[model samples]
Target: MEESEILRRGLDAFAELGYAATTMRELARRLEVSHNFINDRYGSKEKFWRAVVDFALLDVQSELDHRMAVGRDDGERLRNVIVQLYRLSAKASAMNRLMSDESTRDSSRLDYLHQRFIKPFWDSIEPTISSLIAAGRIPDAPTHIWYFAVTGPALALAQDPIADRLNPAASPMAEQDRNGMADALSSLVLQGLLPLSRGDATDRNG
Candidate 1:
């Protein structure tokens, strides 16, 4: 009934069922609405899926934009962006799940995701990437490698079942734990990607 609730449930259903197997009727049932609600309101199932994506990703895009605007430098900006992304993924990983499934196949949905989210996201971070490359903090790598590097780390957040079994206390779903987890991930990722300074390397070597 409520638009946000509908979109959230739809996003989760699509992520769980996959695009083809998730019928509009099933979505309506999940949402506890009439089976034709999407057809009547959104025009079609494809359009409904698009709406769900648009709704679910808006906050993430906004967070990235806000984070990109404020960092002391490119490296700092990259770290801030990654940390914010981890926070968001911990908040809700449905979009990531949907993306993981869609990425394995070539479909219109995948194209839509690329055109709408993936390309824009990459473009948004191009300045940071360029600055890092120039500073030799990161390599001048291919787009796909950068893509996987940035996004792949967050995939584990989507696996609550495994996490609950393996380390219940460290579950990312817990809000109080998210900031520490994000910071830890940012440190781990940046340390591996970034070239250590002369003094830092010397300290480690010593």
Candidate 2:
């Protein structure tokens, strides 16, 4: 099989089993190859894990870069990025689960993900954020807080199984529901980031 196909299957396995639980032998078995073949192709389990993450994030990074480049203004760029992020979170539940698993602890794998995927993605959006702040389109808040505000809801919904049972209308698992949730989330984040109105500013000052 092609290397890309191998990496794709590896991503699915890693996403489902996480880094610690996923064995190279099992992965090879799933791929219909010998364990030695996998090791020979990727060198080690760590390398294979890294490859999985890289493969999963490759399209996301590309899409983000394209949207950010094509956006006409700070507001538009930010909106586009937020919408894209929400869409990805809703669609890639398994990948999100894997990321969540990694985030609960400190490890070389986590660090590698940060350096290879997360940091670069954040760096691509930082310029648009800076522009938005300078233009007073978004509040002058710490980047980390902004990140949480933008991503927190989608991640929560993706990880929470009971969410749909509790509120089927708001669940993003269905295509229609996912689009609606994406719209709502984008609006929520955008409205929160927008500059305070004159009355609100005056009241704050008073």
Candidate 3:
């Protein structure tokens, strides 16, 4: 099988079956390849996970591009961005499950995710973040906090029954939802947090 196809199958299997439960043998079986073939192709489970990270990042980059292309207004742009992020969270719940479920089993793997996937994801999203800063909507909001507020809902989607209680999952958000979420988050940065330090805020308010 093609290398990408093999990796894709491995991701699906890992997500569905859990990382430990999904062995190279099972992955090979799912991909209709011999166990030895799987080993030869990916070397080890860790290597396969590294490939999944690349696959996931590629998906994220494409989603960000699509959202960026779809709108002009800040609210509209932000809404589309939220939708993209939410979808990614839902699709990758398995990875989150692994993090929570197997954290003790292999702490290093989770650390790898924080280093490779999470940090880089934040870096990649920085430009859009800088856009909000430039617009003065979030002049005082730290970039990392802005990152959390914008992406938190997406992460919430992966919740099991326990987490659902803390943050319920609604439908994929209608226009009103988008507007409400965007307005609330924007206000948290603009009106709730430290007021804009720039002279523009004074002029506008005065």
Which has the greatest lDDT?
A: 1
Candidate 2 local distance difference test against the native: 0.76
Evaluate model 3: give its TM-score.
0.56
Query: In model 3, where is the ten-residue run with the lowest total lDDT?
Result: 171-180
Report the C-alpha lDDT of model 1 over 1-206, residue by residue, as the tens digit.
68999999999899899999998779889999998888999999999999999998886787888898897677667877887887787666788789888989999999999998888888998888888888777888987898788878776667666766787775544444656666777678778876457865675599
Ranking, lDDT, top scorer first: 1, 2, 3
Model 3, range 1-206, lDDT digits (tens) per residue? Answer: 77777777777687678777888788778989887875587678877777776665566656766786775554445555655666556556655454445444656667777686666666655666577668776555787677667666555444545544544565333212444444455445334333444664664488
lDDT, candidates in the order shown? 0.81, 0.76, 0.62
Off by over 4 Å in 3: 1-9, 16-34, 73-75, 95-121, 134-136, 160-206
Q: Which candidate wins on TM-score?
A: 1
Error of 2 at 36 (Å): 2.4
Residue-wise lDDT of candidate 2 within 1-206, one digit each (tens)?
88888888887788778887888788978898987976788789998888878877877888878877777667667777877887787777667777777877799988997898778888988888888778776778898887677667667645546766777875544544666666777767667676446864675599
Output the lDDT of residue 41, model 2.
80
Q: Tell how far residue 135 is off in model 1, in angstroms.
A: 2.5
